[model samples]
Structure formats: C-alpha cells, structure tokens
Target: MGYRFHPRSRTIKMDDWIFSPVLQRTYASTEAHYLLLRHLFEGQPIAYCRVSATCNSLNVKARQYHEQMGYKYEGTFRKDNIARWGTPRDSACSSMLDDEWPLNKSVLLTYLLATNFDADGKQIRSLQELRTLQTRCSL
Candidate 1:
C-alpha cells in the first residue's frame, strides 16, 4: 500500500493499486487491473481502488466484495436496465465516481506489433506471402 498527497487540499491519498491485485478476491482487488487500465487512459490521480462494478447483474459474492471496498452508489441506471431486461431481471444499475477522475496510466498497454519484427521471425510479409500462407504448397 502507498499514498500520494494533493498539492491544493493537502489531502493524503492511500493507494494499494499494485498490491490491490493480490488481495482482489475479497472485493474488486482482482478487477482493479481493468480500472487501472481505464485510469491510465484517463490519466488521473487515484487515491483508492477496487475491482467491481454494480452496473450489471453481478453475483452476490461480488456485491458483498464491492461493499467492503467502500464504494457507494453515485446513481442508478434504471433506464438502461429496463430498456433491456425490464421487470424480468429487475436490473437497475449504480456507480461510484465520487471524484471527477483519479489515477494515472503513464504505462498502460504495451502491444508488440508485427511492424517491429524481422523477415525470419515475423509473419507480417508482403500481400503475396499472405496468400501463400493461406494455401498449402503440398500436392
């Protein structure tokens, strides 16, 4: 666990984002990874973390887990739920965006592209080679 201080409010934010993953099964600690990715793109300072969303029909285990993480309902997505399942599922939704945005993702997705491989090891060849690979040369 670690903490970061805000310059203006002099507020102290404690975060275990990295370690959160290890303790995720208890709550959203497991799902925090996805949030981390989202936060990376949003580029905000995250003081707290969790790994679940109450927006869908998550299992009871997940619901309890999220509750333990200190996330309160911000709003309900009653319309979206009714538009789909309606009374059948009685599916309403909620969120916990208490702050505008938090967390930074200076290092997020790192994809290794075909554009960076050599002729010997890379499958990305010219259009002609692609056709050849599609068909077998064997009789």
Candidate 2:
C-alpha cells in the first residue's frame, strides 16, 4: 500500500522515485506532487504540506526541488517517534488553486516558466529533456 495525506500530518512522505534518478533532475516528482495536490483535494484550500528527505540519501538536490515548487524548509526533526532514513527536512508548502491560477495566470505562467526541473522546477524545456531521457514527466 502507498501513503495517504491528511490535515493532521505534520510531515508527509513523498514518493520514493521522486528523488531517485532523473526525477530529481526534473520536476517529474514536483509536477506529480502538484497534480496530486490538484486532484487530491478536489477544490480545497491547502495551507502547507511537510516534505522530508532521508539524510545522506538526499541533500541540495531534494531541497532544490521543494524550493522551486514553493516549499520552504521549516526545520529538521531529529527524532519524533520512529527511526527514519535520516534527519527529515522540515518543509512548509503552498500551491496554486485551480481557480486562482486563472486570476494569476500571467504570474503563475511566469512562475512555471522560471521553474526548471534541473536547477529549477518549471521548465518549458522539460518535455525535450524528458524525450531525450526517454522518461515521462507527466506522472
């Protein structure tokens, strides 16, 4: 079984493949996450979502993904209750609303354009890059 999201979840475990291999180089994970957010809530308000990375397992690469996707690191969790891969990153998250994206179309578009999967989150070149890698960013 996979993980589920809830309002009470302080830190949510993102998909594994998201940070593995090319997904990290591209926003496949981020887009997937956004699409997940867009579809999961089905027209609901999201204040934030906590994301964590396994220590040594990921570092700047994972952090970069969250940043471009609009997640801010809150802090780290040394130990909560269970043992984890590493210290989990404390991330504060936010996303665009379906309707609000319309009002902020231009701004949102620019944000998307500026976002690059590699070194960025939104990348117009992402398709081409994915094609070269024989990978699909669409989740």
Candidate 3:
C-alpha cells in the first residue's frame, strides 16, 4: 500500500492496495485497511481519499471491494500504464470524500463490531448485507 499527499487539494491518493494470497478470503486485510483509513481520517487533514485498481483480472476484483469499503467509482484511465509484458493497462479510479467518511466509517465499524458469525465461524450477515442495512438506515 502507498499514498501521496496533495497539499493544495488536501487529498490523499491511496495507491497499490493489494494483499497476499494467504490473507485473501479472510477479514484480516479488510480490517487492516479500515484501520489505516481510520487513522488517516483522524490524524490528517485530508479532504479526499482516492484509490485505484487495475483492469486486470486479479485487480479487477477490487472494484467491488473498494465500493464495499465506501469508495465511489469515478472513472477508468484507459491505457494509463504499460504492463510488464508491454501491453497497455487501464486503471479504474475511485474516491471517498470527507463528507462521506462518517457513513462509511459507521458501516465499517458495524461490520467489525457485529456478531455475524456462529460457532463454526460462518458468517450470518456478510459485509454487503450489513452495508445495505447501514445505507438504508443512513437514508
């Protein structure tokens, strides 16, 4: 993971947010990501946080994940970068503004604090379900 501060815009450009295979399918990565986001929100003067994911098969999965994490898909930068194999790659961008942080933070906290799992550790209410409920209540 990486970020750059834009002093003029008061924004944090989140970059290269990816996890290892071992952490995949677990809440560890999500939890860690949220914690970091909370830290930034609390400790920084950031007005906007932006994240980008590539259009490749692996990174493409993050588009929905970013939405679940409270980011709104802005647009894709076509042929923004060249891949290791020399092919052009597209980058999908998303952002969360300061005004949206509270709701997103609440949704994240709800998922983190909820008793959504049973004895066997199977989830009763997924993040998506919790997010849906949170959205409805927020409205």
Predicted model with the maximum lDDT: 3
Model 3 error, position 40 (Å): 1.7
Superposition-based RMSD of candidate 1 using all C-alpha atoms, in angstroms: 17.8
Sliding window of 10 residues with minimal summed lDDT for model 2: 101-110
Clashing pairs in 2: 115-121, 115-122, 116-120, 116-121, 116-122
TM-score of each: 0.29, 0.41, 0.83
Tell me the tens digit of each residue's lDDT in model 3 across 109-133. Answer: 7777637657765667777887789
Off by over 4 Å in 1: 1-52, 55-58, 74-87, 98-139
lDDT of model number 3: 0.70
> How well is each residue in 90-131 modelled by candidate 1, as lDDT tens digits?
222223342412211211111123452365544334323332
TM-score result, candidate 3: 0.83
The regions of model 2 sitting more than 4 angstroms off are 1-4, 7-17, 43-58, 80-139
Give lDDT for model 2: 0.41
Error of model 2, residue 28, in angstroms? 3.7
